[model samples]
Target: MRNAPLGALETAAALRRGEIDVRELAADSLDAARGVGAEVGAFAHVLEELTREQARTAAEGIEDARRGGTLDELGQRSPLWGVPMPIKDLTQVAGQPFEAGSMALRGNIATVTDGVAQRLLDAGTLTVGKTSTPEFGMPCYTEPATGAPARTPWDLRRTAGGSSGGAAAAVASGVVPIAHGSDGGGSVRIPAACCGIVGIKPSRGVVSPGPYSTEGMGLATDGVLSRSVRDAAVGLDLIAGPRDGDFMPRPRPPMSYLDSVGRAPGPLRIGVLLEPLAAKTDVHPAALRGVERAIELLHGLGHVTTPIPAPFTPQEWAAFMPLWSVGAASIPLEAQQEGELLELTRWLREQGQGYSGVDLAQALSGVQAIARRTGEAFSAYDVVLTPTLSGPPAFPGELQLPGGADDFGAQCAFTPWTSSWNMIGNAAMSVPLHREEIDGTELPFGIQLGGTRPGEEALLLALAAQLEELDPWPLVREPSAA
Candidate 1:
């Protein structure tokens, strides 16, 4: 009961030692979540009584396991025992209201649980609530018409990059230590960079997105937004693996993700990418400073770093937009709800609807071609490091509507490097390694490190954890202190 907001490992050990009651821990988490959450607009729903009930159930089960002499097995099965985990509104949770940050289906309830979400519960995670996201998760910004915009703790007026914006905001603001996030075209990593947290997008199939989902353009996959690499690894372990009828399935990782963090990745070759595919803007000085520091740190740790060429052509990059747009229109939005969509969503959907089946197929094939090309180049290097975004968090509505033009091309300029990992189905992480004062304000910036292949996920985690140890960022920010 004494630990107010312990880290993932500390929380589990505390729960095992009976030093803290699950209900109290959950209550504390909910209080913090709602307290900072109110101003940040992080949650769409706070499953209050449901969270308490879940904590009570897990607490009783811990005692039951102790009496039955199966405590060690329980520990092995549930390493994050009774810790709080917030569900991103992008995923479905059975019986929970889920509209995905839209007014169209505001009262719709999830009839079946998403596979990634179920695995979290089975691992004894105390589910706290749901984080807000963009409508149908089409945009990288997180201001939804149904609720308030999800804002950065560093500057409330700045954007909390999305579609996992609320998840990043809550985790970054010390509301919860870790929260579920999804990365499709940099949704997870983008927000993390904005808020100064770790966001890892696993290999496409490593985490399932099933049981009623259109997230399978092989783009969006569930992950975690956390303060530390180890916390993200704990989340990956709990959620990784295949479901019974998965869209994209891969073999289990060679080792538990949690175990990989403490193990060193060893010396390796690293590539630095400055110009991202299709991006026209020059790299922001703040962003370059963060990744430059990362390169220096890696050099100090005995790794080689050098410049790398951009892998995709302008034509290949152009095709991805239509392919992703086709996926957006593929979703079965009820005819009645059609009028409720944002102008940007409706316009994108219309563009997708105009494409012939052959056109859509060609677009998907083009995307795959680009992915293959990128993957081949990645094999030569252990890791490719880049700035997670072109710049620090932009002002909240700068790229959003209400007088804003919905030019995705312009938005993509801000986050050109991140989505390519999604296209290639590689594991990537945003490490908060740099902070600097600009225009009389100091904000955090992230450096990205991505794996060449699925098996390289462990190496990526180990490397990120090593960086955190060598030059750690503030784990979390409390709004009260701000």
Candidate 2:
């Protein structure tokens, strides 16, 4: 039997106390990536040689710190030191494959590392490989035509969720304790909920989107997928900061996010909304039950839960679709390369091309209006609660539909509650608080928590940590080779 893996924080602590070395930890992680990760199709690439070299370098650096009597300080500065994690394929790591889950870019390697990837390297994390994402990260599912489908370790037939689906699978299946993920529109949180893990989507501008910030109109930001809230918080601290040319850099937090996890958030007003905001689909009972459980937990913890109207409207969603299509259209591709694009990507691109510049401007203005309305509505509460998805985890290929409205509509229905927070530019997370047996397999269901204000991730983390303490979720699933 394979041994359970230690979480990011636990691994860092062990390295600090000399309980384990970085090389050994990296080896174990690589083993899992090659073994269970392959079985789950969680990794798009595995850099065994690069990982081994990094482990040696990291182990040497730790030894030097120990000899200099600065090991404690090093640990304090880089909380994720010696941790093995995978970066989402959407982010560039120089010399690594930068396919972005598209067959057209299959052999392309990154020439320059993205700002987020550099920050992770500075934190002393060893990158095992790139996790799978959907083509251009336009879809919510991660069944890329370039490689294997990223499946949930909980059930191989089910999707891991995307475009950070592979990252969630790796974390949930013990291939790694935590993995780097990005959230454009529930990409991180959707997969986290599906795989029974924690996903953190920081407020807009909290994490820099440098070197390529204009891609998603600032809707997408890098985040983390991890087993524990504290791990996610530590991850936030590692990568949350302003770059030299950020469009709208957020101010630094008053305290470290890890510190916030321990502080008790006093009783505060939490608004619960069960209605689907953007999609005109009925919320599934399983999804509603997850929110109901979260409400009960909040009540028991001394916080008040009140039902609130959906702050977002269908009209705003109509405006948002054009912007999303425009994002897909913005990708620089050669005319001849268009045929290499996925059906969904091509459809979105075509839709984007059909919109006039006037239409694009109108859409942008509409998005701003939606953001203003959402901010005003959410100001009344400390946090907002909803189901992470409108339904349970989907089976492989279940969400795929014919190109155009059918595909787009199916995506929205599955992830009705997530994109609104992206539009609002506020912090949000998916916390796995409930599970149910489906076809004899226990599948995880998570509730979404949105912070009232931008850069309020600390508040969300505090509540998630409290809930974890009261009724802890499993850290990882049993050893699975699919």
Candidate 3:
């Protein structure tokens, strides 16, 4: 279990150094997952033999590298090697089944892993299994119709924020050091905030969404959830790049994101946003206190912290709902109709049904305008920070719809802070900055850092690494007294 707690980079080093056998590591991880998965509901599919086989192959390659006096094919024998990792159920791994967290495509299996998953394998990552998500990733809360809701390891009665809820719960509970997560409107960040880990949504095109997808219509990008910021960065480094054919590739980083995290961001001017530009609800007092504590931490770290009012109107925020509905339209229709779709998915699809192509185009153009406006707004600052969620984690059943037109109302109630960055097409991360006092329960609070449109590689990680040193967040401690 101690070895199992190692981060991605550390696990790789131990593997390449031959200090630990990859097979044993894989067995340990699988054992831990089996023991804990039932309690936390973190996995949708667990592949025991497949993981051992992959780990054995990595061990052989590492041994050969030692004999040849050269690094393995994964390049430099990086720190992620031999580490068992989970892919969020939304992503496709070659020869694995991908349900997109719905029963509609219950029998559907993938033929080839996407580029991101391939790159992780190339980096010597051993696949453990697929984590859970809500139906087609429709809601911020993960209470799917088919499987048990992905519960927080800290409190089973509460919901693990979604749609990356399973991934966040897995990492937070030490099932794995890190796991893949995608954000088509805060899927990664919302769950990360709820589970108390680091979840980053890369800027549009920063990471490839195809060989399979063009875009989630500017509402989605792929990234990861991890207990540590560095683990998240290294995972991104393995997968961030342009595929053979892409409609819009993100501007290349001058260097690897892993390298960027090590460099200190010179004293920064950080602007704190207490209110979400789009949400009608105000942030809770505890969340506000978390922001205040982070500001103090930033001041101690030699950065200037200032409170700034954002320049967007409520009408502008209201206008983007249709664009989100268009994304609702984007979920493969087959996936939507699969086995009784969840309440949230049925609700979003109905919203999508009302929109025409012209309506979608108008929504796209409007989102682009907001992106332009937000880019200008951040021109005066180095980074903008805000709480990841407006309130603490919600309990199971607190966010469900009444199974009709009210589904739209349910979605609005479920997610309040995560969709705006997707509309602006900016990279945003939910860093676990603080915990709550009640029951000494870990209420993971997020500090959202968004950079200028194309400046994602430099700004997002730089700020994250800085915060990593300033206010290192602890794991959302499991409640049992060991």
Candidate 4:
């Protein structure tokens, strides 16, 4: 079977040239999922029958388009036509299992397709399966009570960070060329960093959260995880746009994100911050080394680098937690079903329940104020750089054990720098750049580049593309001789 050894765009080109067929691509992806994906528990459900049906339909459509002499136009409209990508379990696909990694929602099937899923489908990409996530996407690690833990392919003992952990694992392990993910407080970037892949969390409203917007707080948005920056850019182009019911729809960029990749983002002013902002944990030496290496690379690329203090404050973090708890509390669950929630999720829900409407209003206002101030402070530079996580990948159960407040704290400490961009609605990306050997296993470390202004994703993509060219990351994990 011809697997996804090529990037998403390359795979699409091959499909258009008749070098590969949709059925062959789907079969390869499915085969990989049943192998490495099963080994790492990357999926909550593998839609084998659904994938086969979709592949058949897609192949027929491609043939019809070719015969009608509209193939080029169709390819232009759907850049990823005939490619295979998986949606995260947090998203609902009509007629598919929609278990968001919780025993409470076991056997629950979605009756509608979310806006993000619809956009991906409209782009001509088939959904091979639903990737695993934490319960209600609450934690930074994916150890759901309902299924196997999503472990990093680099080391099966280490966690593939969540709540987009499985998405990262799938892409990094060559199950698919790219996958859909969502970011709320570093969900996408954290897992991408852990698994040694690229993750792009676009600015708020870039991708619609329609039909049933989660939490309605605007902290989370759909994103893309892939092995290369260009692939992530193409994935973003496929799904990014304002839907009719979107509350905050940003204008589309003049140039598509794919067009922005590799373009010269003229020597940008880059601010580097090595300190942890939201969490109290100290940055690990390995993480620091990653940042230092990134700084050297940026300097070599002619970008001006300056040391900057953590732009966020403890007061901002204090304000942000209540808002997060409010989201957790808002999750629909019956009293009996609440017991099915993980300890950390339950604790967060309880914390949310404690806040009055007035308290929520106050918290929202505080967050908005902090966002404005933080944005103003960041205006001095084009992009801010930091380590994606405070440390390397955590072993399974390392962060969740001793659950409750401790679990939340452990997650925050691990992903110390990624949430600030989410708070301010700016674009952020995790680019794998460094590796370190720990306990006889070599693990990847990612450095983050966050755009200073909202809707500046093009700039970040350009910079990431340059970095990718300079130090290309492996498209898939090296095969093990087990």
Identify the superior model by TM-score, candidate 1 or candidate 4.
4
Q: What is candidate 2's lDDT per residue for 388-465, written digit by digit as tens?
A: 998888875558887567888888989998998888789999999999887787888999999888888999999999
Which pairs clash (backbone N, Cα, C closer than 3 Å) in model 2? Answer: none
- Candidate with better TM-score, 3 vs 4: 4
Task: Please report the TM-score between candidate 4 and the true structure.
Answer: 0.97
lDDT of 3 by residue, 172-253 (tens): 8888888998887789998888888888888778888778767757678888888888888888877788876776787568
Sort all candidates by TM-score, best to worst: 2, 4, 1, 3
Please tell me which model should have the higher lDDT, number 1 or number 3. 1
Please list the residue runs of candidate 4 whose C-alpha ends up more than 4 Å from where it truly belongs after superposition: 1-4, 479-482
Off by over 4 Å in 1: 1-4, 68-70, 401-405, 480-482
- With a 3 Å backbone cut-off (N, CA, C), the pairs that clash in candidate 1 are 1-20
Question: Regarding lDDT, does 3 or 4 come out ahead?
Answer: 4
Better-scoring candidate (lDDT), 2 or 3: 2
- Score each candidate by Cα lDDT: 0.83, 0.88, 0.76, 0.88
By summed lDDT, which 10 consecutive residues of candidate 3 come out lowest?
A: 473-482
lDDT by residue (tens digit), candidate 4, 75-169: 78888888989999999999999989999999999999998899888777879999999898988999877788898888888899999998998
Off by over 4 Å in 2: 1-3, 479-482
Candidate 1 achieves a global lDDT of 0.83
TM-score of each: 0.95, 0.97, 0.93, 0.97
